[model samples]
Target: MRKPAFHRADERRFLDERGSSGPLAPNGLNPATIMEKAVRERIVDSYFYKEQCFGVNEADIVDRVVEHVDFIGGVTGTVQKPTPFLCLAFKLLQLAPGDDVVDEYLRHGGDRFKYLRALAVFYVRLTRPDRDVYARLEPFLEDRRKLRRKGKSGTSLTYMDEFVDDLLTKDRVCSTSLWKMRRRDILEDLEILEPRVSPLGTLEDLLEEEEEEEAMQNGDDANGQGHDGDSDSVRSVSRSRSETRPRSRSKSRSRSGSERERSNHDRMDVDEPGTQRSRGGRSP
Candidate 1:
């Protein structure tokens, strides 16, 4: 398979430690060579220097370093090892701080490009404080795009999230209080620093009060219905009694009229004296 563009470009100037023909420094590696004439001339003519009034510009310095690494037969020459041009550029920027240069680099630095992003990260880490570092770099941890890294025998893919993790923890990219601390220690510190009070507590209390009020209103409705039922039952009983009272009075009047008619018939029988005398003569 073909290597990625970045990996191919990165290896273009890598120098192999063994079988190298040159005067060795104390580090047992060949000293870096001067930049190619053409590349040097381009750097001198670049507008980056002109905009800075011939003063030192970090972006221009970084661009020169990248150009030097990419150039054929330039200082570090074409070799087969990892290059330190990025680290050198980072060091140069750190030595001379420039907000305008940093801003320009960040604005132009595409996050998809690992080298450019790495340079931006290094600039932020060296210049910004711990709090700002975490705030700024945390968002990059969510990026999951694959990046290619040259391995000993082959290339391996790594996610951007993993790269960011390495930058933050393994590489100590930012100078925070938890720098070099264990994960457990960091968690403990976070727990201690987090606020104990929650913002939802008041909302919960309000919900509970609303629920209680609903319960009370339901109970009141139930009690009101029960009272109405009792009143209805009492009215029904009184109405039945009132309806039976007129019937009882009519019955008493009919009984008194029958007794008076019986008394009048007995008086008529006593008043018939002629019939009684006729019966007495027949007996003599």
Candidate 2:
């Protein structure tokens, strides 16, 4: 007969038996034990599930996993888990892209180290290490190697290369800190001086460059010669007095009361009973 699944298969079996929902452990271990198991298993199943179910699209899942790992890894001070855990979580994430229900069960205080390690591996893979993100991450490798050198008590690096390569090909749901002294040493070796914007250019140059781009696009449209046969109806109407009426047209239609009074007076003088005014405004 096949041996039982690792951890609390019997308790899991019991939970299945009672059909009761409660705070169940991955095996029979309590929270601390669970964390310990993460170190050994090299994976964090629940975290993986939670990430896969976060309602992200397939294309976005890897990025989301990388982001989550970064956020958590930064908190944990390192991203290194047991190889077994990493491998399993990686496989599960790849398999569960269509299942969007994992988020419902997410809880705080889970295993941080496992997920953090997963995230770093996932990030290295997602960015493919050929771009700027990889360049930024190169600084972290010494810390990583040291962590691995600490033996199983620390993080695992054996499968890192494999994990990274797999991340490049897999649509996987996935998922450090250290002190300044060692960080400084690593930085010195990597030649990563603090970022500096050189005297070669200024913010004004950037703005001018943007303006030039926009002007060039507009000029391209204006200089194009293929539309000469197109109708000029809009321009024709705008330029024609018959088609373009002044805003005062309605005012003229309903002449203001003062102007109306003036007109009435002038008409009355012309049509008076005993006097006649010539069209030139003189009485005749």
Candidate 3:
């Protein structure tokens, strides 16, 4: 048996075909392919250079770490797990913590996702003093905006206030007590924390309840209309019967008047015959 010879056309066909595994072009690069490659290289270089800077005692690495951290922070909405990357960047800048970096993050951090802010809070907690952490992160508890998160089932929205509350009260962005590792232990050994509730799920439940109430109200209105129709039919039937009773009474009165006139005529005829017989007998 002879093996088939690989050709450039075959490689191009393979790259052009879209499937579960991503697109790849060997001979000619599409714009999409080029952009994807560029993004991949940037990510790889960002991590590699940061790691390389970590190995050496370099002071200029702070700028590179900060730039990468800011980039990751800005992309928190798209990236599923940004904390690991952020923690790595924080570790790289551990020796010489820049006040400008912290200030810049604090100023622009509100525009990022809440999880990103939580990760930033974790970084601050680890690096800054306790007083500075309180001073910087406490005001975020008042944020009213929601954070969207993707899960196994679907996407869910949550309040930033709740996340900030957890950070402030528990000294952690998320409750560790509810972790799978903690749950795997004996029930008695486990300290259960309040489960994080998604605002989106709650809103959905409320909307369902509202729809049910509206359906019930509509059913009641339909029943009310049916009852009103029944009442109207009954009233019309009663009115027709009342009108018929008056016509029957008038007919009865007319028949009684005719009977009285006939009796008066018969009495007059009998009196006239009696008077004539009496006059003839007296003359004879």
Please report the candidate that would top TM-score against the real structure.
1
How well does each candidate superpose onto the true structure, as a TM-score?
A: 0.34, 0.20, 0.33
After superposition, the stretches of candidate 1 with alpha carbons farther than 4 Å from their true spots are 1-56, 61-85, 93-95, 111-113, 151-154, 171-284
Residue pairs of candidate 3 with colliding backbone atoms = none
TM-score, cand. 1: 0.34
Q: Compute the lDDT for candidate 3.
A: 0.48
Candidate 1 lDDT over 32-53, as tens digits, reads: 2222224333333444322332
Q: What is the C-alpha RMSD of each candidate to the true structure, in Å?
A: 17.3, 20.5, 17.7
Cα lDDT, all candidates? 0.48, 0.38, 0.48
Q: For residues 1-284, write the lDDT of model 3, one tens digit per residue.
A: 99887433222232244333443222222222322333323433454433543443223433444444322221133442333334343332323335565554555644554444554554454444444555566667667767654332344566667655554555323212211112212322443333334545687798999999999999999999999999999999999999999999999999999999999988877767768889878996
Lowest-lDDT window of 10 residues in candidate 3? 175-184
Name the runs in model 2 displaced over 4 angstroms. 1-37, 41-193, 196-207, 225-284
Deviation from native of the Cα of residue 62 in model 1, angstroms: 5.6
Span of 10 residues, lowest total lDDT, candidate 2: 102-111
Q: Is candidate 2 or candidate 3 better by lDDT?
A: 3
Instruction: Report the CA-based lDDT of candidate 2 relative to the real structure.
Output: 0.38
**Of candidates 3 and 2, the better by TM-score:** 3
